[model samples]
Target chain A: MTTLSLGAARAGVELRSFWRERDAVVFTFALPAVLLTLLGSLFSGVYEGSTVTSAQYLVPSMIAAGVASTTFVNLGIGIATDRDNGTLKRLRGLPMPPLAYLMGKVLLVLAVTFAEVLLLLAIGMVLFDLPLPASAARWLTLGWVFALGVVACSLMGVAASALPRSARSAAAVLNLPYVVLGFISGIYYTPIGALPDWVIQLGSVFPLKWMAQGFRSAFLPDTVLPQEVVPSWEHGRTALVLAAWCIGGLVLCLMTFGRRSRQTS
Target chain B: MTDHAVRVRGLRKSYRDTVAVDGLDLDIAVGEVRALLGPNGAGKTTTVEILEGHRSRDGGSVSVLGVDPARGGSSWRREIGIVLQATDDAGELTVAEMIRHVARYFPRPRGLDETLSLVGLESKRDSRIRRLSGGQRRRLDVALGIVGRPRLLFLDEPTTGFDPEARRQFWSTVRALDTTVLLTTHYLDEAEALADQVTVIAGGRVVAEGAPDTLGSRDVATVSWRDGREQTDDPAAVVARLTAAYGGPVPGLSVTRPSLEDVYLDLIGVPR
Candidate 1:
């Protein structure tokens, strides 16, 4: 119980530190909003024959993509820097439980991801004239997707931190997944139908695809999109798959991060 | 009367193919400031880390405050404090905020104002941690270690980069704490100034352990005058003889015992 409280306090401190940097806030939230606006306005080709606007289709995916990038790249780089500076080793020597330290990091990821999602959604609604979901059920689905995306991406960030020996290398490793997934998950473009079958299958195994799909369900009406072999917005299956990825990611993160800490110490 | 704050029997540790701590034994009583002096890679840091429960030993029986640190839980950790060599500088929080945040983890902790005053940073309580000077930052590290009012504290080369004035101020702070302090340093003067007992480790083994005044147990003393000098086991008798010859106190005469550094250098077999 004390561990949990300590973790929450430390997480608050971490969040405050991150929010103090004006450039980081801009990079985390504003860039995604700006990109969503630019791409939504210029890319009407996305829904030429459909009834949905480009903003309606692209904003949700961008929101998902923004969450993923913040969790993986931002967190991965931050932890690596802490390691390089001996901050992690110092914390290990304290009386606090190991879980407290990890919980703090996880909470930091959650706070940042939430801020990013809200900012993107606000921009989409106010500036791009995108409509909110019509019912509480649809909004609930969106919430589940956002929550699962945070867990999966934060765990992936912890896993990626182990791949690089230094902070710079960790940033490089993190950027790879962020850039590739942004394209493969159709954040900047609508390629769900055009992507190769195997590529889509592999993407389905990850949370990004489900997150995008769930967001689309909330923002877009079913009548406008083309009929596919299987509908993208099956709420039950999307939640199940994203939940599974989150669990798998948690296991991988615990194993990899604990092992790395011991080895380095 | 003999309850040791720390007791170790045959401590040994290895890193893959290389051994770090090798069959080391030590016992330090409560309230004793024991200084572990050695060159780099002499296993000082490794041994300290193991004692702090941050590293595991291959073999050892280490009882710190009546419990083995290797298996000690959070309760045991509450009794000990460790000042690491470096800290995270990313946070924009002020020193006061940082201390308050860490204080929540301990069962009982010193007040924030007392801690700030103890570290001589009362004026900088509102200053951001990142804006502090190097000496001020190190003081913050010390402040954090003592804020919990730990029964035993480990300081690793605490004053390595400090200027003379800053180092003196740090020594005063350590003196004021009056807790059991186990420090490791390459500076002999620091040991002589602060340590009640000194232990020198060389090549992963204890070379000597005793008070700073009589470390080497060398009986010989040097008697010097304006003209010449002589070595003798009895410096007082020689001083009396010299005074008689000069028909008064011998001019510029002095009897000198070996300095702790000289004895230490001789024991470690390093050419001065």
Candidate 2:
């Protein structure tokens, strides 16, 4: 078989193992959807002078968070666990190419992230009356934002996997940043404008904030524009920041991934 | 294509100020099962890792399957298999699934059923890897190593934690394979059982190299007769002289040579 097909087969294996774990499947797929339901119900009123309710505004932001969970958090802990378990060493001894292993990981992230988004979107539409993109342009924006967000987060996760000393510490290392970024990036809070200026500035430095903002522009109406941190959606800046992170993240991954000297045993 | 599956000259490796392997030389002919017998910290693992391409030598000319291991790539990797000392990977996958997944990496892998049976894991074929006992896990390690049908296999302390029965079974499995094997072991009996040639190493160098029965000065035999016992290089002559003296079948007569363990300890500088 060709390398691509072999990589696909590896993806199948990875997916099978992932599902069989039970705990990981529930944690990765269910967390964001559960959070969306509770948060959307608790914050019910529409924003001032706009038809978009707090829950409607939250749907898009939650979608962004779901993407991060499935890609960044998933790959981070997964790779670290693989390293600790001697999977990396065993694969290094085989005839398999490094690219094939990478293909398998990337494909796995893409698949789980796709499923995560669908589940979140389904909950948003069913529980909070969230609407789908109304036009091809809006759909295009969603497409590019989802694509860029998944790439940047996945790369960062791969790079961060090396930071933890072992698999036992991977979740603590990766989740600290993930949870902190969600709150500051306005996934939990609506109308990011309401947060302190310093908090807004801090959130602006990360990709999650830009991803949430991009998703808001696609799903929310212009009437809610006055409540945004910026007067406009600033789609140009959103694309630029997320795109830049993609490049930077890829560089970091290439530098740190698989660079550690493995034990000789 | 080379007559020797592995060849090394002046192999050297050091960690900081401590030297691991110092000017070691080795050669293994195709289809030869050579046992590298050594104590801990004697550079046996270092030498094997360098040859496996898992490590780099400080200075040496080393070749396995006619390629410098430091530069060995996927094509070179295809011709060799490695069973590491201990590992706990692929625990989530069933035995059959993990083996099948690994087999896809090679051009001509053994059939899954045949591979499982070869390692005596047929009963655990559908069981999760994490559920297997320690010995069963080691057998799985061996199964994965040979599934690719590699021409040369490197087994590093392959039976470190096995029971006697399991070790014997493992030796039989290794013997069944028609491939060149470089086995690093501490068990003299295991070496005697499986190796065609035994190389005893100490201080990162070969102290003795020969067949297991003749590795050290095994030519000296202890010839016992009814009168007494004598250590002699010419056991046949001594026995004939004793028989003539007795003028009949000798009583309490037996001839014995130094055991491999005795010779191994002497080579490694350990007092009996």
Candidate 3:
């Protein structure tokens, strides 16, 4: 009970602190929708060989990009700064469970990721004529995929946060790698077959590609599946891959945060 | 149950090969204001962190509020408040918001308004934390530290950067808390003014521990004249000899006890 209440309060504080910065608010919510329109319109709104609109592909891909953009950067840079600033040390000394602090960051990013996804989803479906999830079951799949993706990305963010020793370097370390993840993971358009097998392996190993594929499986029409590298909506494989990333990312987050806190204290 | 709020025996901590706290022992009775006095890099923070359970010690038997901090759980933590040695991290929340949020973590907390008034931040309650001045931020930190209504409070270098007036105000605030305060400070005056007892630590070991007024020849005056200074066992004897030599009161003679700073400097072996 205490953990839950503390988490709620932490989340409240995190959100208030987060939204106070106008740039962070715009970057997390507005940028994804704007990117979807620009990229979708630029690509002529059609997949290379399919009748499906390119917006449909970007709807899922850019959402993953958006999650990476905000949650990863937010968790990575925000937390390292917090650690450097002694915020984590102060919170660790509190009576609350240590996980409450972690939960607060995770919950804040998850909330923002949801809002980003919804704003993009609404734009994709309404303005771009991106198809809606066909059935209640499809919507349920979208729900789980969204939940898992945000969590996995946020966890990865927390884990990666420890990479940069100081707050000043965290943004560079965090955002630079994200561009690579997006490139290979088709967060932007790529001819999957033209790419080397190592690229496929690399993208599959991280959460970005799998999370994007999972979202596609839930939201994209069946006809667009061939355009995806896997050539079919491998829903089971998508779940397996995303679940692995989610669990693995969570473990990594716990270990990295534990180690960093010990060192700082 | 122990009558002491904190008890330690032979506490030890090392970072890799550097021993930070070497076999240090301390005891603080319940409701006592005990100050850990030492120069910087004298393991003051390391020792306090060990007690606060933020860092693990290599070897020691320690108890805080009757529970070993190393093994202490959430309920044990609830009984103690901690004011760290760093700046506040509220970042953007208003003064009241940060306090309210921190208060939710404790099982029993002081009222929000009451805590604000206690720290004299009621006037700045609506202001963003980033806009607060250094002293105001420090006061907010103390406010958050005590809002949980802790029975024992650990204040680590609480007034390190305050101006004279601010420091005095902070001293009074700390005195008014009415809780067992175990504070660490390098300022001898802070220890002299706020602590009932002061323990001087050097090289990670206690050199002396006693009531502040009686701590180290504090009552012995060092007689000084135009030519020399003498730390005498008997200042009156020195004074009488000087009076006889001059056939009256010694010219430019002044008798003064070593200030706490002088004693502290002597304790830490920083040549005076």
Give me the TM-scores of chain B across the candidates: 0.92, 0.94, 0.90
Q: Alpha-carbon error at A117 in model 2, in Å?
A: 0.6
**Model 3, B1-272: lDDT tens per residue?**
47899899999999888989999999999989999988777888888988998778899899989888989888888888999876657678899898988888787789989998898888998999989988888899899889989989999888877899999989989989989999998788899999999999999999989998878878777899886778887899999998898898687899988788888889889885
Instruction: Mark the regions of model 3 whose C-alpha exceeds 4 Å error after superposition.
Output: A45-51, A190-201, B224-247
Per-residue lDDT for B39 in model 3? Answer: 77
Off by over 4 Å in 1: A22-24, A191-205, A227-241, B218-220, B224-230, B233-236, B243-257
Model 3, span A217-263: residue lDDT tens = 77777776666676776778877878898899989978997788667
Tell me how candidate 3 scores on lDDT. 0.82
Report the number of backbone clashes for model 2: 0
Winner by TM-score: 2
Task: Enumerate the candidates' DockQ scores in order.
Answer: 0.61, 0.55, 0.66
Tens-digit lDDT track for model 2 on B134-198? 99999999999999999999998999989999999999899999899999998999999999999
TM-score of chain A of 1: 0.89
iRMSD per model?
1.9, 1.7, 1.4
Question: How do the residues A61-105 of candidate 2 rate in per-residue lDDT, one tens digit apiece?
Answer: 999999998898889888988888888889989988877888999
Local error of candidate 3 at residue A13 (angstroms): 1.7
Q: How close is every model to the real structure, measured as TM-score?
A: 0.91, 0.92, 0.90
